[model samples]
Target: MTDPAKHAVLYRMVMPEHVCPWGLKARHLLRSKGFTVDDHWLETREANDAFKAEHGVKTTPQVFIDGVRVGGYEDLRRHLGLKAPDPQAKTYGPVLAVFAVTALMALAVSHAAFGSALTFRALEWFIGLSMMALAMLKLQNLETFSTMFLNYDLLAKRWIPYGKVYPFAELGAGALMVAGVLTWLSAPVALFIGGVGAISVFKAVYLDKRELKCACVGGSGNVPLGFLSLTENLMMIAMAVWMGVMALQHG
Candidate 1:
């Protein structure tokens, strides 16, 4: 009889958030072992039917080796003899762990360049950690570098959301960074946030001489207008660039 394992296949189904974190290891190992791995991926709900029919299963990350139904992601790892890393292990534990380290790096870069090392100022020091926020801040600050973008009338009229625009951009980047940590799109989110933050910061420095009022975010009077403000924005820009570089390295 022919060996069924000779023509084995590997299958992976990725959905909103149920993808196997270690699936890459199994696939790579199989390829390295001179196995004719018939690997297939189903990324949509519509593709589930065909996979379910073939595997007699209706769940994601279904694993089959030599046409024998093993199980989901875990079974696939087992079939391929891929050992699972400890959940509590610190090194190479999760993909998010890498991003988390990048986030820390961005914050560290910002702090090393500016701001006091106070705990209350920690958030401020780490503000540029996310790529999206950094880029946005840079772009927004490029012109006038402050609530200076908004006229006094608009500030008084409570149209501050559109007045400064940098904060809104920062807010969006921050949200993306926070969300990225919890989702598979962490790299993309970080890239975008870092880009925005960097843009705002770079702009602030580039347009250092422009005079602008500090309506603050939501009239909060947080981000001031001046060379210091420009310095602040650049700090964020550097952070974004760092994050983008990190993502590219990981990818």
Candidate 2:
């Protein structure tokens, strides 16, 4: 008798116009798990449909191990005791990455300029750099970001042009703040936009209880609107206030 554990069969779609990604993943996963895959391709839509009907399965990329049907890519993962990704789970990876990189950048700049990494300037740079990074994400596709921003931003909804201007304003303010220059200009711009954004995020997520995607990372991300979104705006607000006070004390 042959050992069935070492052998697996996979049926996946391979049409001329497109190929199923899950099918490729299933094959790779099976190979990585030390199983020899007997790959079978359903090259046509008709064949795919017929195979699905015959197997009584709605989706393709079906895997069979040792004559036992193990189902599709997700099912194969479960059978192999692997953790599959959950589509509904919210992730803060983008924001976390931005914060982490900006924090490092702040320390580097502080050490270079002030001969110290843990100075007051480092905190300001961290916030400023983070703001710039976030603005860059939105600026990647201004139209898309503006469209999504309108969904929950109060000022953007009231004045449509504000959505279009937001990325530029954020980028400009962040750049100026990081340079520690033009405090008179950057402080007010940061204050106004941050104040408005904080209120809008608060109303949308808390008061109205609406489930919305954050436009912070980009228009095309799945990051849910919640605490991080509010925190971003709040940081800008706090930075603006602190900068304004410093400018006043110096003047």
Candidate 3:
């Protein structure tokens, strides 16, 4: 048993219909941290409201240590040094999710169009859709994306306006490739940008040994600038070359 001075009091809402998850987490956190928790549950809405009014706080589960209020779950986490300062800290989750969803969509489209799930056409569709999706993320906030891009992009760092135009170029090429039209335009655009992007990413990550977030998905994305970024550029370059060769063969 911990000393009385190390006791934590937690008040959380628990009803037949609703149970506050944060309260449970707070209690667990306190218990894990070797604190003896005096847990109190507010069973009714009126009781919960009254408890909030009494404490001068709006949200549950509130924690108290040594007769001092420690706020809610997030606040408690902060007090315990378990919460990161930035809530939107960098993570590869957004980029991974975008790729996974777009790949599935490409497969579905391929199945519908050519009646085959595993085909070269599916790969083409996947690459095209991935580019468009990534471009869309950048287009969400061009200013932010451009700013982040300028951090490591060699060309963008030199010509500031290139960062602003990059997303549109990617989007245009992706759309054209997906439609199997305007290969003459799409191929050259994809090739040029993809070539530049590959070199920039390689130099920044491998040569200069700079660790930075990728601006591939969006300016605010937490995707790291490394292999995945390189792979994306390589995919674009390969697709452009393939499309150009096919066009020449047919012409």
Give the candidate number with the greatest TM-score.
Answer: 2
lDDT of 3: 0.91
- Put down candidate 1 lDDT per residue, 29-96, tens digits, no spaces: 55665566677877776786787786577665554556676676556566667775444332222223
Summing lDDT over every window of 10 consecutive residues in candidate 1, give the lowest-scoring window.
Answer: 89-98
Candidates' TM-scores? 0.29, 0.81, 0.73
What is the number of backbone collisions in each predicted candidate, taken in the order shown? 28, 0, 0
CA deviation > 4 Å runs, candidate 2: 1-4, 11-24, 39-60
lDDT (C-alpha, whole model) for all candidates? 0.48, 0.94, 0.91
Clashing pairs in 3: none
Residue range 1-251, candidate 2, lDDT tens digits: 33456999999999889899999999989988888889999999999999999999999999999899999999999999998888767788889999999999999999999999999999999999999999999999999999999999999999999998998999999999999999999999999999999999999999999999999987978788999999899999999999999999999
The true-structure Cα RMSD of candidate 2 reads: 3.5
Better of 1 and 3 by lDDT: 3
Better of 2 and 3 by lDDT: 2
Index of the highest-lDDT prediction: 2
Candidate 2 weakest ten by summed lDDT: 1-10
RMSD of each: 17.9, 3.5, 6.4
Model 3, clash count? 0
- Relative to the true structure, candidate 3 reaches a TM of 0.73
